[model samples]
Structure formats: C-alpha cells, structure tokens
Target: MAKSNKPIVWGLFAAGGTVCAFVIPVMILITGVLLPLGLFGPPEASYESMTRIVSNPVVKIVLFGILFLALWHAAHRLRITVHDFGIRNDQLVARAVYGFAGLFSLIALVTLLSF
Candidate 1:
C-alpha cells in the first residue's frame, strides 16, 4: 500500500471551500455594504467598536481562521486553474501557490495579533 498526502490537502480544500462559500460573503456584506452605510452605528461609534473587536483575542483568532482558510482556498483554486491553463509542471506550480498561501497566512496572523 502507498500513502499519499492527498487526503490532507483535499480535507483543507473542502473545509476552505465551505468557509469561502458561506462566511466570506457575509463578511463582505458587513464590512463592505453595511459599514459604509452606517448600518452598524454612528461612524465614530462603529470605528471604536471595530477597534474593540480586534483588541479581543477571540475575535482576532476568528479573523485569523477566516483569513487563513480563505487564502488556502484561493491558492488551491489557483493551482488547479493554472493546471487547467496547460501549465504542465505540477511540482513547481504547487510549491508556488502553496508558498504564497503560507506566506500570506503568516502575515495575516501577525497583523491580527498586532491588534
């Protein structure tokens, strides 16, 4: 029998896809549509509330998870898309896409923690 890492990648892909499909859109709506429209509160109040949201450790972790999963999901999608576009070098493509994902994920974690 042979072991492969496909299961792990596929697991993250599935979970990330679910997160991207569901949570990310709502995030866009809240941050994009509602925030600018003053639906959350007065502008100053919203800014203070948002600052408070990031200062809390729990929210930071949640944001990290959302960002990390989204980045992973997009990287996987881009890898597949590049292959579909006739890029025959799988190893190189895999490393590039996943490398960028990892780098950005680390950046996201650091940025979140800084708050």
Candidate 2:
C-alpha cells in the first residue's frame, strides 16, 4: 500500500473554489453595490473612488490573487469540458489550453496594473 497525493489535490481544488466563490462575489458587490450607492465617499468621486479603492497595497495584492485564481479555475473547467465532450487527444489539448490561459492571464494582469 502507498500513501497518495490525490486527496491533497482535491483539497486544494476545494479550497480554491470556496475562496473564489466567496471573494469574487464580494468583489462584485463592492464594485456593483457601493459604486452605485455612492457610499464610497461621494457621487463625484468616480476616478477618485477607484483610485482610493484600488490604490491600497492590500487591495492590489488581493485583486492580483483573485485574477490569477479565476483564470486558473476557468482554464481547469474548460479543459474538463473539452475532455468530457470526447475531443480527441484531450490531455494534449488541455495542456495547450492551460498554458495559453496562464500566459494570457499574466499579460492581462500586467496590462491592467499599468493603467
């Protein structure tokens, strides 16, 4: 008998899903809810509001974390969908898809932060 790492993989996935689901909705809420409500100081504070919210070091870190996790999650689910549809040579396809997903996600993150 041998101890295996399968459970660890599954646990990591569960954690990722749980955290993304929770954090993503909150991110949406803050952007969607408070922005409309003008609760982030004032209605005139449009760019000011965004700069205030995103300028915090902690918020930048968290946004980057969420963006990467979201891309990884999307890539994984899309890979499975391709596999489940009986696409031929799915493992090879999954690898290519994920590699591009990661590369593009990094590019997008960099582009976003430059603004």
Candidate 3:
C-alpha cells in the first residue's frame, strides 16, 4: 500500500511547533542566565549596563533575526490555529493576523536598531 502525503503536512506543522516550543524556553533560559551573570550587569546595574547590552553589534543582529523569525512563525501558526477552529469566513482574517504580526515584528526590529 502506498503512503498518503497528507501526513507530511501534519509532520511539518509538528516540526515547526516543536522548534517553537524549544526556541521559546531556550530564549527564556538565556535571558535568565545572562541577566544573573551580569551580561546586562548586576541587579544594581545602571543605565550604562543597559546601554552596553544594546551596543553589541552581534547581539543586536541576533536579536533582530530572532524577532523576525519568531513573529513569522507565530503568524503562520496562529493562522493555522484559527482555521482549525473552523472560522472559515474569508482570507481577510488570515491576512490581518499575519500582517499584524509582521508589522509588530518590524516595529521591534526598528526599536532594537535604534538602541
């Protein structure tokens, strides 16, 4: 018997979801580790520490990449989620959801660049 291809779509979705699951927690852990280690400086760290954190070229680039990918991932997943819930009304909803996600992502990128 030949295997069906429909399962492939589900598999891809699962893979993406798994990545998201891991990415979110791992990012959180990094933040926790770095903050306590004073990568952003001590609890008493002043504006200087915050400034230093934002000034690193590598860190800024990585942050921008992560932000863009995360937002795109979120929008794609949310679109599927809304569809799964049987809200088959129009394409507008999906567009709006993805559009808003991208817009916010761009805003974050700009803010990060400035800092």
Candidate 4:
C-alpha cells in the first residue's frame, strides 16, 4: 500500500476544530459581548488585567496554540468549501488556504511572544 499523509492532515484538522469549537464562542462572548457591555468590570480594569494575564509566558504559549489552531481550522474549512463549489483544483486551493493559515499562525506567535 502507498503511504499517505491523510492521517497527519486529519489529525491537525480534528485538533483545530476541537480547539475552535471550545474556545472561539467563549472568546466572542467575552470580547464581543461582555467587554463592551462592561460585564467584566470597568475598561481600565479589564485592560490592565488582560495585559497582566497575557504577559505570562505560559499564557502566551496557550494563546498562541489557540490562535494557530483556530486559523488552521478556518483555513481547512475554507479549502473544503472551495472544493465543494466545484473549483476542483485542490492543490492550488489547499496551498493558498494552508499558506494563509501558516502566515497568520506565525504572526500570532510573534505577537504573543512580544508580550
């Protein structure tokens, strides 16, 4: 049997999807709803607290993982959606989508580490 990379791809896809599913909605609720509504105390307090939390190295690594996984998950979905739309040139689509994901993941890593 020919060796295949499907398992590796699928593993990342699954892990990313799981991370996105658990994290994204909570993030949206906090950043989108709670913060603006002042449900998390005052703006200054929230900003200061968030800064403190993100400044920790461990937190930075965790945030980077979440951001990277989320980007990859979205990119994989977009790639599949493009394929479903009958743009059968999968190599191009996969490269474009995954490339964007990789680029954003790198950016996220840098940004997180800057803190």
Candidate 5:
C-alpha cells in the first residue's frame, strides 16, 4: 500500500472546522452583535484595545493558528466540493486549492509576525 500525506491535511481540516464551529459564533457575538449594539460595557472594541489584544505573543500564535487552519479547511472543502461537482481533475484541483491555502498561510504568518 502506498502511504499518502492526506491524513495530515485531513487532520488540519478537521481541527479547523472544529475551531471555527466553536470560536466563530462567539467572535461574531462579541464583535458583530454585542459591541455594535452597545450591550457590553464601555465599548472595549476600539483600535487600541484590539492592538493590545493581538500584541500578546500567545494571542498572536492562537490567532495565526485559527486563521491558517481555517484557510486550509476552506481550501480542502472547496477541493472536495469541486470533485463532488463532477470535476475529474483531482490532482490539478488539489494543487490549486492547497497552493492557495499555503500562500495565504504564509501571508497570514508574515502579517501576524509583523505585529
């Protein structure tokens, strides 16, 4: 049997999906609903507060992980979806989607490290 690296990608995809399921809703509630509606106290949603939050090394790493994994997850999902949509070129689609994910992951890493 030929061993493949698909497991690694699948693992990332699963992790990303799990994180997104748990985190995105809370994030939307906080940033999208709570802050804008002024239901929370004193509006700690300012630029400075955001900057401070992202400034912490731990927070930066977590954010980067979430962003990178989410991108990869989306890419893999799109690739599978394309295949399901009757695309016969699996190799080409895989390359394009994973390449896009890698490129964006690099960009996110650079951006996060810059901050």
Candidate 6:
C-alpha cells in the first residue's frame, strides 16, 4: 500500500468547509445583517472596535487559521473542478492552485503577525 499525503490536504479541506459552513454564516449574519440593522445598540461596528477585537493575538491567530484553511479549501476544490472539466494536466493545475493558496496564506500570516 502506497502511503499518500492526500489525507493532510483532505483534512484541511474538511476543516475549512466546516468553518465556512458554520462560522462564515454567523459572521455574515453579525457583520452583514445584524450590524447594519442596528440589532444591537450603537452597533459595535466601528473601525476602532474591530481593530481592537483583532488586536488580540489569539484572535489574530484564529482569524488567520480560518482564512488560510478557507483559501486551501477553495484551491483544492478548484483543482478538482478543473480536472473534472477535462483540463488533462493535473500537475500544472495542482501547482497553480496550491501555489496561489500558499502565496495568499503567507500574505495572511504576515498581515496577522503585523497586527
């Protein structure tokens, strides 16, 4: 039996999909729906407040993880989708998608670290 690294990528995909399914909707509800509708008093939606919230190291790490995983998840999906569409060049597609994800992940990490 040949061992493969597919499990690691699949794990990331699952985690990201879970986050997208659960957390992203709530985030949209809070920031997109609730905040705009003034559901809560004075709308804790100020730029300063947001800055403060993300300033915490733990928060930064969490956000970065979510963003990173989501990017990888999307990239993997895209790779599979292109393959399904008969691109016929799995290696090139995989590299392009994963490279894009990696570049963005690095950017996200750097931005989070800066904050």
Clash count, one per candidate: 0, 0, 1, 0, 0, 0
In model 6, what lDDT does residue 100 have? 98
The window of 10 residues in a row where model 1 has the poorest summed lDDT is 5-14
Write down the lDDT that model 1 would get.
0.90
Tens digit of per-residue lDDT, candidate 4, span 1-115: 9999888887888999999988899999988998899986897989898889999999998889998888888888898899889999999999999999999899888878788
* Model 1 Cα shift for residue 80 (angstroms): 1.1
Segments in model 4 whose C-alpha atoms lie over 4 Å from true places = 40-45
Off by over 4 Å in 2: 1-12, 29-44, 108-115
lDDT accuracy of residue 58 in candidate 3: 85
Error of 5 at 23 (Å): 0.9
- Please name the candidate that would achieve the greatest lDDT relative to the true structure: 1
**Per-residue lDDT for 13-44 in model 1, tens only?**
88899988989888999999999999979988
lDDT of 6 at 23: 80
In order, candidate lDDTs are 0.90, 0.73, 0.71, 0.89, 0.87, 0.86
Q: Could you arrange the candidates by lDDT from highest to lowest?
A: 1, 4, 5, 6, 2, 3
Provide the TM-score for each candidate, comma-separated: 0.83, 0.63, 0.64, 0.85, 0.79, 0.79
Clashing pairs in 3: 38-41
> Where is model 2 poorest over a 10-residue stretch in terms of lDDT?
6-15
For model 5, the stretches where C-alpha displacement exceeds 4 angstroms are: 31-45
The runs of at least 3 residues in candidate 6 whose Cα sits more than 4 Å from the true structure, single-residue gaps closed, are: 29-45
Residue 115, candidate 6: Cα error in Å is 1.4
Q: lDDT per residue, candidate 3, 1-115, as tens digits?
A: 8889647545544655666676777777767676667676556673677678868888888777666666666766777788788887547776887698779878977888887
Query: Relative to the unseen true structure, what is the C-alpha lDDT of residue 6 in candidate 4, on a scale of 0 to 100?
Result: 81
Candidate 2: residue 7 Cα off by (Å): 8.3
